[model samples]
Target chain A: MYQFNLHAILGYFGQLPSSILVTLEITLIALGASTLLALPIAKARMSGSRVAALLARAYVELFRNIPLLVLLYVYYFGLAQSGLHLSNFWATILALTTNAAAYGSEIIRAGYSAVPTGQREAARSLGLRPAHIELFVVLPQVVRVILPPFANHCIGVLIGSSIAAVIGVADLSDWMLATGSEAFRYMESFLVAAVIYIGLCQGVAAAMAALDRRSRRGAY
Target chain B: MFATGSVWDYWRVFVNGLVLTVELSFIALVLGFVLGMVIGLGRTYGPHPVRLACLVFTESFRSIPPLLLFFGAFYGLSYTTGVTLSPFQASVIAMVLEASAFISEVVRAAFRSVDRGQWDAARALGLRFWPALRTIIGPQAIRVLIPPTIGVYVAVLKDSSFASIVGLVELTRAGLLVRETVGDSLTVFLLLSGIYFVINFTISSGALALERRFRFAH
Candidate 1:
């Protein structure tokens, strides 16, 4: 008969709270950094300036093609050898941010494209400042159009951050692995991790779904 | 990478690892596709209990992180059941299981996008359920499924790198091995990154071509 143990998991509840915080720290930083980078690249992709578009495309192509794990190694392991050593925490943030930016730019560009070109004409005819046109007219609609994919991007960022654990960053996955190895109760430790991930992801999905509906209902 | 041998020795090791990575990904994708179709069909058209089961399956798997799933499947299963899995087996199982969830979501969306009228009309024309799906709805759903399916494939390819963490000596692990001997982490990893980037770039470009083809056809 297979035996089950809850105590192994319950005992580690103490570490989990802080681990989740670290995970959130990485996730939020990456998301914010990526968004900062993504907006400009998305704009560049749509801009008629061929040079800007080419550079943006190059950035996306490079990051998109490389696996995140390889990027992690390059940032944490490779760059260190070259004498620009970042702590695992910063390295993870940088690697994940770069990756997230590439993907986010593509999604945001798609979102902008999905909007009808007539809207651009409307904004142009309004004689709005260029900045005002993007900030007020283009962005609001793009936000609605991109939210679903954006939510998926957030989830991907969350999952990809698990690689930070590989670099011994003490994030949720790292803590769980440590707990499992310490207790020799790997099953329980992993189950706790799985539960935490599920809860967080489901929470994101629910919040996104609600926002999606609310936005469609003219509550935005 | 040269562990007291020619540079070609380590290059051969990396090649072997890359081959294994490809094999594992191919198996996982094939299994995932079949499992996803089953879950998609069950969720969409099966009886009430089956649909509920499918929904639960897809959502739970989709929400969980692949790494967590990897650890859970690798250690948890053996801990509970006392049945051992090879590292490759465990990792591939984990990949297939989680990927099927995402793939099924893609399938479900694609299937849903097909008009309800088509389904009813197929039935009215005396087509049976499976035949109706195969003959009428399947082709249309394929269009919706293509981009996402390719996206998932690219994801799984990259994701297979995690198998290294679970002790599968795939490409990432091979690079790690090279670093251990050569003590030059950056150059070795940069090489691995370049190889992976090239392969993934090819995949994405192919997907773009396929999407363009679809657009031109339509």
Candidate 2:
């Protein structure tokens, strides 16, 4: 009974590119920031100090347990009440970054563990300081081992970034929904958004798989 | 900056919200599990074309943003079909689809985790495909399946908070309501986070127990 208007959605083609750009921008910013932040947290977690490890563990557990949307509410609206103004863009970036970091740290930590113990012993026997061992022995290998999961986490972040739309970020989801409401053709716009999201995520996955293959080939 | 009485009132509202979250997640878990089993089995054991179809289904759903599904159900379905769904209904549909995507992957992985020889063993014993799968492989796969499935459930519970965006008055939505009334977004959200943390932490700990049981039984 309902007439679907694909043209109505196509009318927004000019705007869709900008919205998609915003989404990619958010995804990259969140992914990069999360990876940077995760390094220290992963290091602290693996540190021998009990207090440091405990604090790191607590941070991961709390963030992983609580929903990212709830945390976004706290950071954006909650902090706003106390005069901490964050633009929609920065608010989304921060929340997604923090959330991604928790998961990234876990993945990176697993990568660190996966490196054989014999390698560590070799570095120790070579009279390397802890810093040298970490820099030379751990960093190179960890980067390679973590890439696959790290790429997976980036894909996860890319998908999760769509949540930014609900907070008025003008991301693809927001733009599509707004186009629908404005044009009174919700189905067309919504279908377009779904296609774009699925396409973009698959693109990331394909890219990651290529990189994974390249890394594996380089391993020999 | 905070009053005890008002805090208590907010607590009541949050508890109400938590109950809805639980109900929503429970429905999603059950429905998704059923669908996941079918998809997983089809992907793992069905013919080449059926396996390809299952692959497309699971991969597309998994790669798509869940918010897109919510938007599709709430807005697109309404537009194209002229059938309006309540926010809760729309949300449950999204949750079920998303959970089924992830759970199907878990199930497929569980199936692969079973020794390939188990199938050969069943066939060697003259058992039929259905009977062999039901009796020999099913129980073992369930053991491998449970921990990851619980992990997925925690994810579903957390994502149910996202349903609030579609106008479902679940836990996160209730937090927003309390923030509006009490004018204490920080305390209210932190309190809300505490509740979520507690519930998810309990589920995660349960996953550890399940994983341990799986290992011990193996």
lDDT of prediction 1: 0.87
TM-score of chain B of 1: 0.92
Model 2 misplaced stretches (Cα beyond 4 Å): A124-132, B1-5
The DockQ scores of all candidates, in the order shown, are: 0.75, 0.78
Summarize candidate 2's per-residue lDDT along A1-220 as a digit string, tens digits. 8877687667678888899999999999999999899989998999999999999889899889988888888888888988999988999999999888899999989989989989889999999999999899887788788888777788789888887887899999888878888888877887788778878978888898888787678563
**Which tens-of-lDDT digit does each residue in B48-85 have in candidate 2?**
99999888888778877777787777877876888889
TM-score, structure 1 vs. true: 0.94
Candidate with best TM-score: 2
Model 2 scores a TM of 0.96
Candidate 1: tens digits of C-alpha lDDT, residues B1-218: 34454334589879988999888888998899999989998999899999999998998888777777778778878777899988898898898988799899999999999999998899999999999999899999999789788878888888888888888999999988878887778778888988888888888789989988887886
Tens digits of per-residue lDDT, candidate 1, A1-220, equal 6667878667778888899999989999999999999999999988999999999999999998888989999999899888998999999999999999999999999999988888788999989888898788878888899999988899889888898898899999998889888887888888778888888888877888898877778534
